[model samples]
Target: MNYEAFYQKSIEKPQEFWREEATMIDWDKPFEQVLDYSSAPRTRWFTGGTTNLCHNAVDRWLPTQAKTPALIAISTETDSERTYSFEQLHSEVNQVAAMLLSLGVKRGDRVLIYMPMVAEAVFVMLACARIGAVHVVVFGGFAASSLATRIDDATPALIVSTDAGSRGKKVVNYKQLLDEAIGLSEHEVPQVLLLSRGLVSTAIVDGRDVDYDTLRQAHLGAHVPVTWLEANDTSYILYTSGTTGKPKGIQRDVGGYAVALAASMKYIFSGKPGEVFFSTSDIGWVVGHSYIVYGPLLAGMATVLYEGLPTQPDPGVWWRIVEQYEVSLMFSAPTAIRVLKKYPLENMQKYDTSSLRTLFLAGEPLDKGTSEWISNALGVSVIDNYWQTETGWPILGVATGANGKKVPAGSSGVAVYGYQVSIVDDATGAECAANEKGMIMIEGPLPPGCFQTIFRSDQRFIDSYWKQHGDRWLYSSSDWGIRDSDNNYYVLGRSDDVINTAGHRLGTREIEECIAGHEAVSEVAVVGVVDPLKGQIPIAFVVPRSLEHVADDAGRAALRDALSKQVDNRVGSFARPSAIHFVEMLPKTRSGKLLRRSIQAMCEGREAGDISTLENPEALQKIDTIISANHG
Candidate 1:
């Protein structure tokens, strides 16, 4: 089906289409209206809905795809793999669900899941879905305080965790932190179902805490399905940082989520049961929920789940997993690619990536340099996609890069199967002409698979997304991008983060891409700082690949000079960085996103809020030192 026809069908007969799609699942109950757009800007798809996400993803697939492998776990250290069949996964999820219910978990109840890349972590999520409970999976690396905040918000009935999880060669004390977060909770703390990974230096299981193995054992004899969930029922609450504010919860509904995941999997993955679809996303994030847990499972495909860092044990860890599982569909972040690129290409040559049919990138926009490099290096085209916690899945992106549906560099490709996307000037809220950079917004309602709300912040949802625009349009993404003459969507950067100097708007991504193209540069992040001369000056924080060649001040200066020249050639000298700070590593969120705001804060000697979300918090101190040394 062509994109245009699919989009028209979705918008013109949205209700009928959604209802027809809902019939694809085995529902304990059916929905009333195919959709309820009466809410206006905060439109609800598949309104008056009734269904269970687990039943749709696992139960239905189990009957036919029972023997089909559903999950592939690549042990980070041992380099060994274990593939789980659909029947095996379904039974495990059922047992976990029975255990959860035994602990007082009920429909509409929330569960805090904090575990490593272990198989049980994935099971916990599907288990929640099986019993109509909402699962809030925090990244395994989150600090106690960060976990505390989320736990306090959702106030889950249970907290599923592990004693330890691997990161590189280090063992993270997950169980210890889980205790701390539970201790800090305002309400009666949720029970912690501890998985025995033995990652912690000191592990303990006391009252309100049971070993994950014991809990599963307790459910050794139960397989009952509590399928009372409705379509619009809250499946989970994934928290996201607001563009201009603090973190807000994005509520996803069971029915709508199932529909969206099915559509995305069938289209984005070009679904084939038993084929391995690997996405290196933390279970804490939305991508993990949509792709890692929901989408692949719904499609009855085997999804690879890795439990450690990419560089851990060795840089070739990811490549080895791909070869080990024959991962056919690989999705990861641009930052990861940048990291792996720093490693010797010979390392990649060690593995046979012939199984990889499609490569995907998200969490942030993909630059031309990385996209082109991946295309040439792996000989596989990168299908760079764009979406957010709000939209659920890729709303504006190329379906599959290997399908000869690729666009030019920088373009996020065209809108997905069923989305009406437009680039509009944020100042006027009017659609921009083709090739004009503007805020990307959706005109029609979101697909049924998108989030439902900001938890308790209905007014914030309206104010943040709706108030700026009239009731007619729903402002979704904070990204700045443009559509070319060929109708290809090219994402710039976040609107609030766009650099405007001498009235010419520049995206940080363009500058970052220019800086990354330099051979000396390993990874880079460009942020707009308040400038006395230009309204805002672009300052770059760079992590060089080889400190040996650029081992001294002279080498640093030479490297900066090369980067400056490259930026001048690519995006004009005016877009060149006011100054380049050489640091050991750029601070990144667990999801591999460079935290430019933190860099800007470090440059200004201000507090970098929520440093806990970072993978390496101490990296900021290095940035501070670099800034200090350069200024001195």
Candidate 2:
């Protein structure tokens, strides 16, 4: 299909276009209306329909794929691997649903799932959907305080968690964290279903905690039927994990989310039945929820659920899975590929990834060097798509398997189907000219699979996402972007990430990308620090190929000079960072997103809040130690 005409129809005649797409899903009842826009920002797709996410994801596939491998779970941390057939997955999901019912969980109830990357997490999520309960899967890497806020807001009837989770050599005591979070929150949670993995000793609460094994044993041979829901009923509430302030619960509906993922799998992901799909992300995030679980399963494809780091045990861990499962479609973040790129290419080349057709990257901007390096290394097409937690799927992406699509080096293609996107000025809300940078905004009613509202706060949703700009309603992405004459869009970075150096606005990513081009630099992070003269100045933290350059003051100074010169020549002298500090690693979230705000906090001699969520707190500690000893 022509990408231009296909996308145009979605915008021009959304009801007609989406009604045709709605045929992909198996709805319990046909929708009375294809599109409902009576509430401007609060649009509904396939209104008056009844459907269940679990039925579409698991049950519908069982007829043709009963014996086919539905989920392939691999945990390098524990050195275990298992694959479940469609029939087996259905049985497992039924057991969980029965267990949830035994604990007094019913339709419209909320269940909190705090677990590591294990197969049981998938079962619990599917079970929640099966019973028509809204499941909130908080990242297991979060600290107790962070978990407390979500527990209070969601007010879950029960929390399902494991005793412990392993990350490389360390074991995170999840039971301990859950106990602490329950202590902090105001809401009284009735029950805590614990999955004891025996990695650590678990102390169960006398009256509140229940063992998962015992309950599963009692519920053996259970066959809980799917709970059908209205098209607009919420499926889940994913709390946005921002650097500061309170988190927002992003709510998603039943039919719209299902239709969106189904369409994305068929058109955007090019997923097919019986094929294997792999996404190197935790189930807590939106990408994992869509591509890892719902998207692949909805398409009747076998999905791979992996636990452990990309470089753990060996850099060949992910590729080994590709060879083992013959993954046709794979999704991962750019930072992970960068970590693998730092090592020898032979590590990845040893595995036979001939079955892999394409690798999709998102979560952050992909640099040209990283993109080209991974594409060459994998010997597969590397496609980049752009989206956020608020939007359930990609806002802009090239249709998978589309021949002769002209994808630019740094662009994440054009807008996806159903998104009426534009680049507009922040102040006047006027559309920017081609090649001019502006806020990335979408004219709503948002397409199927997009977030409905901030959970329980429609007014805040309007204020935050859909705001009146003169005569039109626009959903601000809070990111700056530019569109070329060919319609390819380039996401520069977050609008707030722009640094005003002597009244010249400079994107932190623009400077970081320039610094990353230095020959000796392996990775770089740029954060804006308060400066008396320039209001905010860019400060860089670079990771070199070796620590030998940073071992001595003279070598460190020379390397910093080279990097500054590179940035000055590439970007501009005004964008050059005030000081370039060398560190072995940059602080990042467990999901591989750079912790720029945390780095900026340390640079200004302020407390780095919430170090618990950081992938490596030692990275930030090293920076502080070095600066205090020498640079200070």
Please give the range of 10 consecutive residues that has the lowest summed lDDT in model 2: 400-409
Query: What are the TM-scores, per candidate, against the unseen true structure?
Result: 0.94, 0.98
Looking at model 1, residue 266 earns an lDDT score of 69
TM for candidate 2 is 0.98
lDDT of each residue in 512-542, candidate 1, tens digit only: 9888877777888898888777888899888
State how far residue 336 of model 2 sits from its true place (Å).
0.9
Model 1, residue 146: distance off in Å is 1.7
Model 1 ranges off by over 4 Å: 77-80, 201-206, 241-246, 401-404, 468-471, 552-554
Model 1 scores worst on lDDT over the 10 consecutive residues at 397-406
Pairs that collide, model 1: 49-231, 50-230, 50-231, 51-230, 194-212
lDDT value, residue 381 of candidate 2: 88
Candidate 2 error regions (>4 Å): 401-404, 549-551
Q: What is the per-residue lDDT of model 2 for residues 1-632, given as tens digits with 9 covering 90 to 100? A: 78788888899999999999899989899999988988787888898999999999999988788999999999999999999999999999999999999999999999999999999999999999999999999998899999999998899999999999999858999999999999999999999999999999988798999999999999999999889999999999998876355679999999999998998888788889999999998898888899888999999999999989999899998999999899999999988887787788889999999999999999998887788888998888898999999999999888863322758877888899899999999988899999998999999889998999998788888888876766668999999999999889988899878888898887788888888777677788898988999999998999887788779989999998898899888988999888888888888888999888778888888888877678898898898886577545
Please tell me which predicted candidate would have the highest TM-score against the true structure: 2
